[model samples]
Target: MFFKWVMLSLLLSRSLASQQEEDVGFTYNGFRGVNMSLDGIAQITESGLLLLVSTTWAQVGHAFYPQPLHFMNSSRGNALSFSTTFVFAMFSELTTVGGPGIALVISPAKEFPGALPSSFLGLFNMATIGKPSNHLIGVELDTLQNEEFNDINGNHVGIDINDLKSVEAVPASYFSDQENRRIDLNLFGGQPMQLWVEYDGIEKQLNVTLAPINVPKPTIPLLSLKIDLSRYMVDPMFVGFSSSTSALDVSQYVLGWSFRMNGQAKDLSLSQLPKLPRRGTKTKPNFLKIGFPVFGASLVLMLVFIIQFIVRRRIKYAEVLEDWELEYGPHRFKYKDLYIATKGFNEKELLGIGGFGKVYRGMLPNSKEEVAVKRVSHDSRQGMREFIAEIISIGKLQHRSIVKLLGYCRRKGELLLVYDFMPNGSLDKFLFDHLSTTIKTKLSWNHRFQIIKSVASALLYLHEEWEQVVVHRDVKSSNVMLDKELNGRLGDFGLARLYDHGGDPKSTHVVGTFGYLAPELSRTGKASPCVDVFAFGVFLLEVACGRRPIEAGASEECHVLVEWVISSWSRGEILETVDPKLEMNYEVEEMELVLKLGLLCSQYIPTARPYMRQVVRYLDREIPLPELPSLSKSISLPSEMSTCGDISMWSPYYLGSTMSTSSSVADSLLSGGR
Candidate 1:
């Protein structure tokens, strides 16, 4: 009797040690008025379904439980067992293409400010990504394979730590209870699917399972990762569903949700769950339902052959598909899709006609996401496999200030490259065209300064931060684009050459805009980071001085922009060269800084140029610019102002290989084009 009393007392104390929220759990058949905190594109539809994300371009949405749940034992400060299950359906206007999917997260806070949309899923932005400061754990239902995060496929489930890169992942599938075999599942299939997430704190194991709406919980989970959540979770953590869309438009819906602490979650009431909206036009007709088996075999075979011959004759669908490109299917666009998106290459959709090819404004089919498609004539001599592979590799780049290269398509006679559409167009139009017009669209000095830094940051990313060192042979104002928010995004990687870090780029024919080419290129056709720095220097001058590098003059003398800026600075009147369109509304110190930096970048000698990393530090004001005496020696400006912008100032200089703004690779394998 005394031993019984002692045991009872110990059990009671253990119960008391547990927090209140740990003993409480919640279940919702539908979220009509549930205590949910919603942000961004998240909302509750009138039908009582939780709509986390709708058909919006590049958006993020989060729906968190209003109160923080006790995730860890209060007395022991150790992670406690928990379970959650939710019914979700994701669909797109198109059949296969869907938005990047959602994550079930237990975050430290309900709101993540400055979180980037798209693949980041509103969890972290570029600056905060992969940082230990983000204390969160999640189970991700990712439909998009992000190479940057090392995702395995388009449909998978993963265990996320502080970052989106999963600690362990598996193809989204569930072991069928009836068949006792694994069956595949597509998260974006537009059919309601149920997901179960459970953690066993004692065993330090996490498991996630998925199945069709009516199926029983699988005995085996789709993904299981052994991780101690106590390392990242606190006593109280917020539980939420977070989703984000890319350029694609898709809707993510939660029909019903249930969660519990220290126990099994209540099963969602499927019968009472809200209905999912119909998706993807009319349901595709299953031809099997319309029996045609009665027809003779010969007749059926002949008809099929005729149909295939007709399709083969149609040039639009004649894609140059090679066996080598099979692995790149996820990154390749269907030719018919691009054709429909660009409205059969109609003139009405023409965004710009450059020397490379015509760029068309397009609304991608199904996603209805806007894109800019540039169609370049194909070169049969270049190996199509390597060419497409290189372009796809470039598409992997992710940065805020660089225009995104989405994907590419290859048809009968041309290669189509797709990019994110910038509504504000090229920066050169605002700088030069606005100079002669009464249109007040001229950029203020503040915008210009920010743009200079934005481009500099992007250049630094290409040169130092990326996996490979990329030398943008053409870094001119015309290549820079402006987003809707007036932020600068450097575009046009067509003329860019990439090499491994600490490796030298192979010598190639001079290929870039005329005035932007480095003088060393004429002597040694070698492309290097210094070559790009020289062009960036010229770009800075073009933005601040509002003049072309080489302008035609009345006599044999042509105006060289670099010399003009240097001469003005030499006379102690550098401010005289500032664009008058700025209305002198700029800071004197900043104006002097940009002009001098521009000079330092455009030094005639390759050894004199500062690396892109140093340039970014200077622009960001993290380091002080060197004084004039030393700065001048590195700059090594011309002895006299040149009447011409052409390198003809240096006698015997040959520029016979300089290509136009849009360089073509027809003659030289390294000639970069659209």
Candidate 2:
């Protein structure tokens, strides 16, 4: 009996000690409503803990547990393990892209004094980034790409050790049980997301799992890395979250958090946690109940005043909208209508993909008219500006050679533009489709000639016939759409600028595609009618030669189509530069005239290039082609003539790549018409 009692006592003591260790770390049922102990930049809100560095730019914010937790002393000794589960959300007040996301940081201090903003995630600055002494371990939930840090994309989770450079990373995604397929999660889409991070001390392994709060825990982890924390961590370290923003703003919220140390704890059942208190539910003075009748009368009066004020404001707003419609002439679309038309912007409906957003083909329910819907990414700095530019530049213009803007939609967090669908897609398809013999689509020489003339007429309308001089900065072959009759229609005026006649618009930023950028625009960072002419020169050459302005070649000179074409012309072998697919079917005289015209418009001097009116006349044979300049002289290339614009503001694919959608849609519907 004595021996049995001793054994029972030992068992009870071990059980009690294990339970005590489990309770060592913190657990909060609800961050805002619950009485949980914690620390760091956390704010009690109706929705829970709002974790933010600041409400403005170039700021860093963090939240951490008040007390430090024990870490492994050495690689050879017993180590402490931990498991943490939390629900967080990222949002933007301005309907902009929110980024430089949150990080689960383990550091020596709760406050990261030297933390940097933007892509640094408030973790490290320029001096200490990628250095060894930083001695920090972080599981970063990054929603913005920082090329300097080698980020995969805008939405990803990276394991960072002492640097912004990730040791291992994976895209933010969750397996949807309802859909039975993995769906890419937009971390900044204002949806609550759940995260699970675990560290195994014995194996020195780390695992991170993520999913939507409404979904079950995925069986597999998004990221798994074998790392020995003892090599980097101090004996006791602060563990919590840190986030920062620059230029772009995002709100971070922590609804609930629970953590355990020393081993795996029971999985948290977040569903049972108390819901956030409803707004206006806080305690009020008891005397308010005694004065109910008087208060009710005041409330009724206030409500009447509020309703009258709202009605007046709405009336004024509608009047302003009516005036705007009279001026712009672009129809305003209902958000719900466009959403339904585009099938909720499904990936399968995607037509053309560009840097700023994706173009989808949708059919309007009432009209049964097919339309190409351009959905600009909310996070894009240029998207909203481009959206405005497109409306101003294309909305009022009506021409047979210009893509017609049907309408636009702007809701709380989305901007969309709708255009008439072009059945034949973009001109690049005809120029490059010959590369694949399996596809029989080809543009005859006559069709190509008509396209050139039509595009020139469109330019003429913008520069001379329109009320304002609209300079299309990005006028590449991809921007030329082909209608059902294969007639060229100018499109994609996102980078266009409208200026008064004879006015030179001075823009601080240079925006255009590579190989097509005008030499003078690089030097001036200004847009003029001449800039469009220079791009037209490149486009003309591309269409005539059925080749890109720049192509992979053995020599640098050979890579530039202009230099190579000039060299061929000097050798009296200009025909060699013509597309082999033409098969000697085109008129030699017409081809030569067009080629010389292209060379004339692509002059090294911006002032030397012919205006859109002269280009139109030259194509129509109304004006004679000008004398060619000396081909022997070396051309001076512009120093700043490179790919411009923020690459993060673009989609992953090239502007005119083949779509993964069904072949029927690719053949019939307009794809890459941007």
Local distance difference test, per candidate?
A: 0.77, 0.69
Judged by TM-score, which candidate is best? 2
Q: Per-prediction TM-score, please?
A: 0.49, 0.50
lDDT value, candidate 2, whole model: 0.69
For residue 112, model 2's alpha carbon misses the true position, in angstroms, by 28
- The TM-score that candidate 1 achieves is 0.49
Error of 1 at 310 (Å): 26
Error of 1 at 539 (Å): 13
Tens-place lDDT digits, model 2, residues 108-181: 87776545566777776534566677678898888877655678887898899888779999889976667777
Q: Model 1's lDDT to the true fold?
A: 0.77
Residue 163 miss distance in model 1 (angstroms): 0.4
> What TM-score would you give candidate 2 relative to the actual structure?
0.50
> Which candidate leads the pack in lDDT?
1
